[model samples]
Target chain A: MLSGEGPIFLQLAQRVAEDIINGTYAEDAGIPSTHDFAIFYRMSPITSAKGITMLVDQGVLYKKRGIGMFVAPGAREHLLAERRAAFRQQHVAPLLHEAELLGIDRDELADMIKEKDPS
Target chain B: MTTAIDIRGVSRRFGRVTALDDVSIAMPEHSLVGLLGRNGAGKTTLMSIIAGQDRASEGRIAVLGHTPFEHGPTLRQIIYVRDNQRYPDDYRLHHVLRIAPAFAPNWDADVADELVDGLRIPAKTPLKKLSRGQLSSVAIVLGLASRAPVTLLDEPYLGLDVTARSLFHTILLREIAAQPRTIVLSTHLIEESASLLDRVVILDHGKVVVDDETEAARDSVVLLSGNTDAVDRVLSGRPVLESHTMGAMTSVTAAGAADDSLRALADELGVQVARATLQDLVSAHGAETPEPLELKKAIRV
Candidate 1:
């Protein structure tokens, strides 16, 4: 599932971040070790470590000297806030561009988004 | 990290054929390096030289700072199993299992047993009678179970089934975590094994075409596709690896990073752009070149 266009390490970091945002890992909950990540992802240990390190650098994950890595306190809120800031450019803009190409007006797009059940 | 294996201007010749030509690569210790190339691209020749099984015609190789050829101490710390490994005429799986430990000082018998069972190798069958996939399984058993500090695997996935391949990967990663060691694996299954590599060294026509960290290599090229004229304009002044022209559309693998200006031009010209994958890079380097693996500036990654 991690196989994407960009570097494997970045993809891995994004996946973990998505999981945190979804509550798969709660605050102070320990994530899998680097070795476990490598085996599960079929990636090298070094790559797995790099991905984990990136999260640590971003303040999303924190390391315990002898134990393992755990989700940083307030990491989910931090990631949600960050993603919300970029949601316009990453999701809404291209979406708007496509809607424009399809001749869907702004009002019609708003209506389309408001409709919950499209039977 | 200190260098585990170092090759300096290593060249190998067989009669009139030049198998390796002044190749040099310094592999960092405890890293998993993917040795990739097309068939007969001198990958095997280079592996053999590093294993001390074959000597270079010109240049030298140092493993752990000691010349490997005919050096018993150094050889003991390294394990190299060829793709087409051969056993005695009457040898069987048990025979190999019993004798391998004598050579590999750091061998782990439990790892061997786990692999043999995981791969479902026939223990009673004669060595010569095993099928290609079975032979590959046996080679993997030796390669990983040996636990050598410097392990060289030449085409370990030659004939492995999907299940067996998955098992091999799991076992390899587990072993590396338990015992950090330098491993250089050569294989043609680029995408399947790309993630398992920390670094990648691509060879074509006996020369180092692309050598860089796997993450860096993946970001070193960009793919552009659109109308022929538009793509041609954006691709101008770029070293193209592979290009396809179908009717009015053209798709190309352009070497080097795609700068903002280039991306802007491509966006304006309706040319879609994406980062090149590892498979794309290897195939691009393998593609016929004007000067046989040219694009020297593109190798920095």
Candidate 2:
């Protein structure tokens, strides 16, 4: 999916992150090379490489000397932490604000969560 | 924090044809600047001269306060990534990764290794065996990991897909934010990369046509749509880059901000005013100059 209107490199970085989450690139598996990505996407190689490098910086992926890159060990945990932080910032706080407006308390929210998931 | 590139009265010519004409520009440090124009607008030639790959027929160029030609220290601080890069036939992706650290003082092996995994590049695959996209990936990795103070990417996104291109934009911004440097990106995808640019330098027929902050350049061109007569009256003696007509309606893109009086007059005439986009500005200027590709073809014939 197209990211928000911004630099092309950022959009590419998001796509790679999404791909990791979606399992298009499995943990510990090598992703497509920059040249391959460029040819597949008809983009410049440098552009494709930018996306890969961003993932590396985020610790979602790690490199192997003389070998191709692999999904870093504990990458899923790292991603989960990041996603949880984002969820709280992007969704939970706003949700809490609306709950306050509706006069819902901690017990009511707990009850709703319990009803949604018994286990 | 000084200017990354400084050019004064720079000119280049190929026989009777002028590739760059008395051009002068100072690239600000730690900013992403877009070098834009139609094909053969001297974008490549100017970049080449600045990178020290080619010499300017006249004038002077200094990168990092040193003349770039054969200047080892200065050259190392600049990375020029282009589509036409050549590699030895026997060389493989591994070779590039291996030697990158030696040349790039700030090279991050971990970043390179992570890229290799994410990109799935074959370590043993020869350069000739790799696909076009694979070759481009090599260039991308080198450019980013090099961490040069002055990084010039010439159409670096040519062979990438939408997803890959988006990733590139993200990484470039994050990296630059973490480690600020001067970056000059040349591309035809104006609208896509417009926001990333701090400033834009547009060339027309080897001459600098538009050089301004990206926002200011966008602000200088105003688009107005209204009655043809009223539009014509306001546009008279003003610099109008382009105009379109449909029956009694006319849309004129005039250079400079619309004054209060002109805005009021336009409103009285039922004219709609809007900001002109960078693409619109470039298209309007490009139309005024001879197409660079056409000129090259003519010279060839």
Candidate 3:
């Protein structure tokens, strides 16, 4: 599941964020601990901790002190809002730029998007 | 942070050859540092000096707060597990594992038993009769169970396959999570164990070259490719480590990230940008080679 796009920890952090959005990790529910992640992924505890810490730092996960980390309240909504903006800027914007390079106008791009829709 | 192993200006010589030269690095408490390099690049010498197996010809070496070489208390707290661990002529796995507690005060027999069951190391098999993989597993068991305050694993997986190696990584993390300790693991498998390292210290020609957090090391170098002119124009002033070209395509591994303007230019020029993995960073520095002529200089004239 990890790619060489950057450090494994960052990739793992992004993967966990994706999981949260996909409803695999429900809001206010405890995710796996760092030790469990290390064993499951065959990664070091340090790496796993870095990934989980990233989520905690981003407010995607919250610590309950004596207990472990739980998905923060409104985590899914927060992540989805960020992901939607990211999709627009990263994917759709790039696609439009490429289309522009190929001499396709905004209308043509819109038409192409509509044609590709199954419904 | 408390320094677990403090090495300063250390150098080692064997006969007329210098194995390590003027090296200094401190490993903090409860860290997993990777010592990476090619074979015969003085990785063994540097680790041996830190483990107190060999004395440094110049400079000081300390484990915890005391010198390691020939020091009883300091040596006992450090476990040095080598890939080619030797045993007495007829020593069986059970006989060796039974005697492990004498050196390490923190030895855990239960952990040893658990590792034996997981790695499937035959307890009664004679050391000589064990296959290469099984022999390596014995070393792995000792390393995890010893629970030494300072543990140095010098490429402990020699004959292990992928499944066995994965077990080592999993078991190591599990044990480290239970009890925190300083670990300096030297390995030829750079990327394979990259994710396990807190920091990576790469050696070439008996010297520490790249020693940084696993994050910074990979991020410091950027890999770029496209037209030769475009690649050179974009990363002109940056330190180019590895460069290759075929026809019009040129690939260059350079230091530092490209700024916004540089990225825009690269995009305009069709230059593709990529990030370097830990392995790419290590391989870009190239390998180490000993000088035959300088061999005589290591000896006292």
Who wins the TM-score comparison?
A: 1
Question: Candidate 3: which docking quality band?
Answer: medium
Report residue B109 deviation for candidate 3 (angstroms): 2.0
How far out, in Å, is residue B176 in model 1? Answer: 0.3
Error of 3 at B14 (Å): 2.1
Per-residue lDDT of model 2, residues B161-236, tens digit only: 6766776776676567556788888988887787667789999999998888776787777888887667766655
lDDT of 3 by residue, B24-85 (tens): 98888888999887677788888888888888999998789999988998988889877777
On residues A10-115, what C-alpha lDDT tens digit does candidate 1 reach at each position? 8889999999999999999999998999999889999999999999999999999999999999999999999998999999999999999999999999999999
- By DockQ rank, best first, the candidates go 1, 3, 2
What TM-score would you report for chain A in candidate 1?
0.92
Q: lDDT for every model? A: 0.90, 0.77, 0.83
Once superposed on the true structure, which residue ranges of model 2 sit more than 4 Å away at CA?
A1-119, B119-125, B129-132, B289-301
Residue-level error in angstroms, candidate 2, position B150: 0.5
Question: TM-score of the candidate numbered 1?
Answer: 0.95
**What TM-score goes with each of the models?**
0.95, 0.67, 0.91
TM-score of 2: 0.67
Chain B only: TM-score of model 1: 0.95
